[model samples]
Target: MLRAIVKQGLRASSRLAVNRNPDTSSYVQQLEAEWETAKPFSELPGPTRWQIFRGFQKGGQYHQLGMDEVMRLYRKQFGDICLIPGLFGMPSTIFTFNEATFQRIYRTEGQWPVREGAEPVLHYRKNRKDEFFKDCVGLFSNGPQWGKLRSAVNPVLMQHRNVAIYLKPMQRVNRQFINRIRELRDKDSAEVPADFLSTVNHLTFESVATVALDEELGLLREVNQPPGARKLFKNIEVFMDSFFILGMKPSIYKYFPTPTYKRFSQASDEIFDTCSMYVNKAIERIERKTAQGSTKDEKSVLEQLLQIDRKFAIVLAMDMLMGGVDTTSTAIVGLLLSLAKNPEKQQILRKEILGKLPSTDRDFSLEDMKSLPYLRAFIKESMRVYPVIIGNVRSAGTDVVLYGYRVPKGTHLLMVNSFLLKDEHLFPRAEEFLPERWLRQKDGNEDSANVLINNSLNPFVYLPFGFGPRMCVGKRIVDLELELTVANLVRNFHIEYDYPTETTFKTTFLYKPNFPLKFKFTDVKY
Candidate 1:
């Protein structure tokens, strides 16, 4: 219904007063205007105001007035890294958009608190907030609680170890991807769809499901988009929009989260519902153990989650749906497009792969991946060029100084990674995707080829997985999934961009290919 309204430009009165202010971008205008005469948020009884704000929260918009607004606000307010002596009573200081700042903000959490990230997150959590905040869920909680949960689960996800466990599933998904593309392209290998975004989504859907839920979608085998997968992608978009509006115009939609609000509210429920289904499946498996009085050793991550708390399981699952799905898919789309635009480099990398072990018949092991330095370099370059998450903001846990500005506590800090990736000073010929730049030369010779994100470079500058103790916990899972899937795809077939344009940028919120990409595969022969 809301989609119909949006498509048709249908009209209706806002259920709650929209913000009427002018300075707030149109995104926040309605809420800003609404705040003009609305009751002070603190004065609202119970959770009415909190609910309204949650219904319409839009944090991304606040970040995306471009970095200029973020910079100006940090400078104008308490200068940088200052206290949030406001009504919310939370400790926060906005940091300058730099690398050192990221290190200070994230590393200093022990002295301060990771709970600074919790309020907005917890407040927005609808059904599973309690469980998400409980003692054992590592990703969503803080302090001793986060420590315990992380300790239990971090082993499975500890950088390299987790990659070994799920390598086969990723390889399988990629082969499935190759098969699906062949089907989609009739006799003419040229018949492949111009856009690979949907294809990557289908691939990531299957990949993450295998690792996270021990389920498979075979979305590629179906040779059509998955219905829920399709909706799940859109739900992510809609929810981001809902959150952006809330940040832009907190007052406007706070009281009247209508129409758009309701659609997302429904989507939010659906997200939780989807998560619950997975959680329940894990729970049932755990319950079988409980029924027979078996020990926790007969458990997977999902089973362990069931033992700790189901609500947290549901939230983690939802986070995967929201976080895991789009990022991996969008990344691969950007990656293929990058190679398509740079055909010479693409061929070189393809030759490099074919020259190596050149077999996926056995389980594609991490060591196999380790052999493909160029493949690793190409993936790193793609991540640098088209990072799915440009940067996520951090509210300082306490007052800190950054870039000559006093960032007061509670001030919202926007970490601009897009700024760093594109900065010519840090990366000479920055726009050009040169994997060789990542390689370090020993003496004057092209000696040891290495792939590291330039250690001499500032830490806060580039954050694809985000920065701080509160950084993305599943970073390894995402890296492994992308590496295995993309390597397999490239190893099996050469990709050409059906369409290429430098100006193409799909969405403002997250980095995506500007348009649909079609690919032609030059079937590799060993």
Candidate 2:
């Protein structure tokens, strides 16, 4: 089909050239020469179709391998550019590890960029019997529909002022999270449970809910917890687990509802219903507050979004709850592990934190957050070393050339950025946990301790939140939550992980922790 399109395009171009002026004809001839010289898409290096199919089977080479490891293997076998044949209703994907290719792809992605992953969620939303999401498909959607929603919510979510409104509320939640960590640790060991990721999940959920639902869920507190909060948290876990299975692996869930799809559908329904209930309650509260003229100085994220449209607000809230929890939790865990492993780095971060606040009891103001360059750099370095997502995936908005190959429009391009983020060429001493690498040099001079990353790093290679218009919508919220949590954590305790650091994360839709997180937290004296 693609070859037919190429041939048809060439014939049309040839016909138009006969009626063109000399300059136009020369330009057309030059374009044709470039196209003819470029290698065909089929000649791109990768596994054969049969190999890809068999490797994904029960006992094949790619079986049971995390997506991160598989991407690494592909790079090792096929070098920078590789073609992954389409299998089991999935589209053919092109994986590129070259930094220039990454830049070219983003440059051409134009307005209304099409990101083609999230098929399972898209299918569920489109085929719902109730048609609940017929109008607003939220962030996972593409083209005009995604653009509309993104534009509507940008004022409430994307702006620094709007996102800063949640700082105080989120700080309260962070305080509770710090206290919960103290309570959860063993008295003798001063270490949290092996399943410490669950605790971090609660913190992320509570933080997101504080902004999204305009109320505290009390998830991190020991007593007086909301009854539905636990159930909502569990349902989100099930939703993420099922999404990983359906999204990453090959299956016939779209034709006939598989067990995983069934679980996914049920979890989706429950999550939507619960979020709807909370949002509706928030609507009523806002209405009453408006009626009595008793609103606060700052509005919650939900309230600001509701002014746009109710249904849009509900869908956006649900998307936030679903997308925010697992990704942020994984990131928090990764950052904590990075700090725990490098005790010297952790101490440096603590000194930075203490110089600003002097006490854990004080809340983090916006000004204080801006001043902590090391804390910000530490987060960036941690994510560089341990990115939560494998890479960014996008479909070609139009026909384009990539790495001397003619890639047709609609081909799914997976920018395998994980390899580039840690590559020695892109980052100096990439393997080491050095926060100073991201810190900007002062007095127009470079020091041995600090690596000037701006001169060496490609802007496109280190995309933790992604790039351009289709980037993560909740990036601001996630950044604030992470910064607040890490600051309060370093100021309050000495984080330590007394174990060998080997194989820490596995890619399950998102890169999640593979092993137990038993981090020891000794109280720090100010």
Candidate 2 has its poorest 10 consecutive residues by lDDT at: 1-10
List the candidates' TM-scores in order. Answer: 0.73, 0.92
**In candidate 1, how many Å is residue 231 off?**
5.6
Q: How well is each residue in 291-396 modelled by candidate 2, as lDDT tens digits?
A: 9999989888898877767787778877888899999988998999988999999999999999999977689899999999999999998998888888888887
Worst 10 residues of 1 by lDDT: 8-17
lDDT of 2 at 279: 91
Which candidate leads in TM-score?
Answer: 2
Tens digits of per-residue lDDT for model 1 on 1-526? 2133222221211111122212236633543444454544233122233542343346632333433344344446534333222223333333344666666555433322354333333444533444533333435555445544444444445546556656666677777887787777647655476555666776777777766665665567764665765566567667655644444333333345556666656677676666667667766766687799984543455554454455655666666666677777778877877777788878778787767656756546677677877787788777777777546666555454444344444456555456578776676667888876656655654322322334367756656776444456678878777776666666777777654475555444465565656567666666
Error of 2 at 17 (Å): 30
| TM-score attained by model 2 | 0.92
445: Cα error in model 1, Å:
4.5
